[model samples]
Target: MSDKLGITPACFTKLVQDLRIHTTLTDSRFIQLEQKVGFLLQALRHSDGVRKVGHRFQHSTSTIAMYIHEVVEAIMTSKLYGIYVHQPTPDEPTSGIITRNPKLQPYFGHCIGALDGTHNVFAVCSFDLLFLHLHAGSEGSAHDQKVLAWAIEKGFQIPGPVKYYLGDAGYTMSENIMVPYRGVRYHLREWIAGARSSSRETLPSTKQELFNLRHAQLRNVVERIFGVVQRKFSILTGSAPEYNYKMQAMIPLLCAFLHNHVHINDPFNRSTGKARAARMTMEAKRARLEIIYKRTEEALQNPAVAVDEEVDDPPEDQPEGLSMEATRNEISDRMWIDYLKYKDGPRRRQQVPDHLDELLLAFDHEGLLLR
Candidate 1:
């Protein structure tokens, strides 16, 4: 059942139930809910012309078109938004993916998620690959940071002062949005090449490199979610076939809702002992959050803590370069100290073989060594 529709039979049934309760969609004498939702899913999965889909379903193109719009309206205007796309609150516990991973848990303990603008949607996604918040229907040519500002203006909330989202260089650094250090190697592939080189120098040579490495690692979640979404929904990968602007924008939001539903209810993704666990109730899933670092408001107010709550929204028209330079530098230096201690331990030997003792050097595009 999931092979063609991207959702299991059980998930499909649950979706129908939710729609029945929360939406005005009702089974008509001519077309049932099964056919309506199925047609909607097919349009999203196949991205074919309406006439082609109508032929496949043995219905008139007008019928298919009407059913698709009805389902879209039902889903978009329903109470399912709270169930599926619930925004993370300041008091909610951190994600387990961050709490369990050693590298991220230390640096990104207060990090709630990653933020990115993609496919005409600005999304904030958790490390677990669930979309926490989405602002869809932006122009494709709009700058990411500008779209983010628009999202904020439209009432997208940041979790809190201590918590932040990891973003790429395309976003500006704010108190609650940490972007990578510019003019440094920030991608995971670049770091991988540096690690695999034969020089045996595995540690980041500078604080900026270390910070960018961690930022890239944490921010890669949004990229991974986008990749998964693209693979699941063909409508996003191919050139859209002249959909109405509203329909084109709503497609991504529908995909995000289905993605979360599948993540929560797909039994094949669980182990034998955890198959029942995969069928968790929505309330239980909401309660299954992880522990977070208790960085208090008093701690933030301390002069030594370097936390700034007032630096969130910068002036709209200005060239602000690295607004949080001191904050990011402090984080990099602290992370570098800890990373150096862990990578180069006390019992490690000082001398190395001649082949391994060669200098490990990295250069920029112009061929200058990166410090």
Candidate 2:
């Protein structure tokens, strides 16, 4: 059941037990809480249509839909947010990719998490589209920046000072948010191509280029979050469930919250141990690659170092008088200086030769290297 449902059996049992203890639903009125939760999980994990879920649960499709909605609402109203989504304090310890790479540590030392918005297809009737356009206002076609602006306007707590989330170029860089430098090779694909190319000319040529590369590296956390969410909840990857617009909006949010819950409470197993070991090995290789790149750059003695470029002023709609262009320039300058110092100070033993760079560059954006 856990294998089919994409969660550990213990996790499923714990979730059901928690919901039974906390939910307002009485066991006598509807199906058992365990079955309700199981049905929802199966539907989410397999994208099993409501009809199929109803058949599996031995209930009517409408009953299954109602119970699923109730379960989602109950979970949302529970302590999931408090348990999983708490903001990190300044003194919180750094881990994961940032800690593994020295180059990334100083550059993204203060970043708490990565921020990015992904669109999920929602099934909406023509009448509901009008309602969404007028009330929700995005009509499922809104830009990431626009959604961010709305959140800011609605008093969403933007990070302050040293605490921030790494965003992509679509967002405006601010005191609490960092974005990639505009008009640069920002994506991992572009960086991989440059790294693998025979021409040394294809490598990052300017301070901004280097900054963008690092920015993309750190900002990828959000992409990984999305990937895991989709992999765990196949309903998100498939066409949206036949729910109404409002319910459709809640689906992703619910899945995200559940995803975080599962991640935080994941029970260790042999597969998990193997995956962790592989990840650590990959991070070590990446650190070595960074060292090699630093050595190569230093050996080449490239004179076109860290030139400050003029950044345009912020647009009128920018929140809190934040100048994204100015923020990017300042951070880029800092990164350039830090990288130069890192390169000149100490050399780690290279894991791969400079001539065999393609072996390292064969990976795609997600760090999954091709054979």
Candidate 3:
């Protein structure tokens, strides 16, 4: 059954059971809950149109469309979003690569998650066209910044205490948002090139370059999440259904919630062996995290660490004065100094092995050593 559906049998059964328990859908006169859920998942997993789904399920196209709407509404109204979406607390200890890297954790400890918008194109019928023209003026493509601004204007709770989402240069930096330095090598590819030719390439020569390198590394999580979603759900990568614009918008959110659900609850992924592996991973991570926390505590206890005495809240009504450029500059300067200290520290000045030094000298004579 799992092979047939492209989802594990347990997962499919769990989803059906969840819908039965949560939604108002019962055995209808024409269709049962299993058939309805199957129809919707087929369409989403395969990007099949209503006509195709109706033919496969032996139902009329309109019936298939109705069932899809019912399932989508049920999924959306469920508690998936609240259960799966997590925001890190301000005082939470840092983890993952951030904890492993001495240079980045202190600088970006307040970052919870990375945020970015993706464009999803759906077909538009004449009715949708007319409606969009009348109400919202064409429903054309929207930029990421514009969508963020609209979300803010609509009273979305922007997380804070300098806990912000990492955005790319496309976004405007604000009190609650952090972006890479403008007019600098900001992309992962640029950093990769620099790393591959570290001896030859000028290494993050300026403060802005170092900041952008670190920013790009952290912000890459958002891209990875997007890639995973697109790969998991063909509906997002392929052409979506010709639903109304509002319904189309809801599809991405529904897919995201479903992805999170499967990731968290899949039985096969949570077997005893996998559980052991996960435990081992966590233990190793915990060891690293302990070292980082101890170092951080020592640094905080040190009397040499300067504490900021001023706390000035900017005027909320004014837009111009709220720009985060000054704050970004200050952070860049501190990061630059921290990087210099790390480079000149005793750990970096360790004596090289005689064999390795000979090899390096040979490479230098052969013109293989980077300038």
Tens digit of lDDT per residue, candidate 3, span 1-371? 54334467778787777777766767789788889988887887888899988898899999999988988887777764545433444664445556565766667666655665544221101100000000121223565566566655644445656656666665667777777766677654344333323252345678998787677655554544544455556777677647887777777767665665566668453222222332324344334334433433454477543111111321132253255666668778999998778656787657221112111211111112110
- Report model 1's TM-score to 2 decimal places: 0.77
TM-scores of the candidates in the order shown: 0.77, 0.73, 0.67
Q: What is the lDDT of residue 333 in candidate 2?
A: 88
| Model 2: CA > 4 A from native | 86-96, 120-137, 153-155, 198-202, 267-331, 341-371
Looking at model 1, the pairs that clash are none
293 Cα displacement, candidate 2 (Å): 20
By TM-score, the candidates rank as 1, 2, 3
Candidate 1 local lDDT, 64-176, one digit each (tens)? 88999999888888888668887888877888976886766776777889888764789989877789988788777677778888888977997666777887777777777
Off by over 4 Å in 3: 1-6, 58-60, 78-81, 85-103, 120-141, 193-202, 267-327, 344-371
| RMSD to native, candidate 3 | 14.4
State the C-alpha lDDT per candidate: 0.67, 0.57, 0.55
Give residue 292's error in model 2 in angstroms. Answer: 21
lDDT of candidate model 1 versus the reference: 0.67
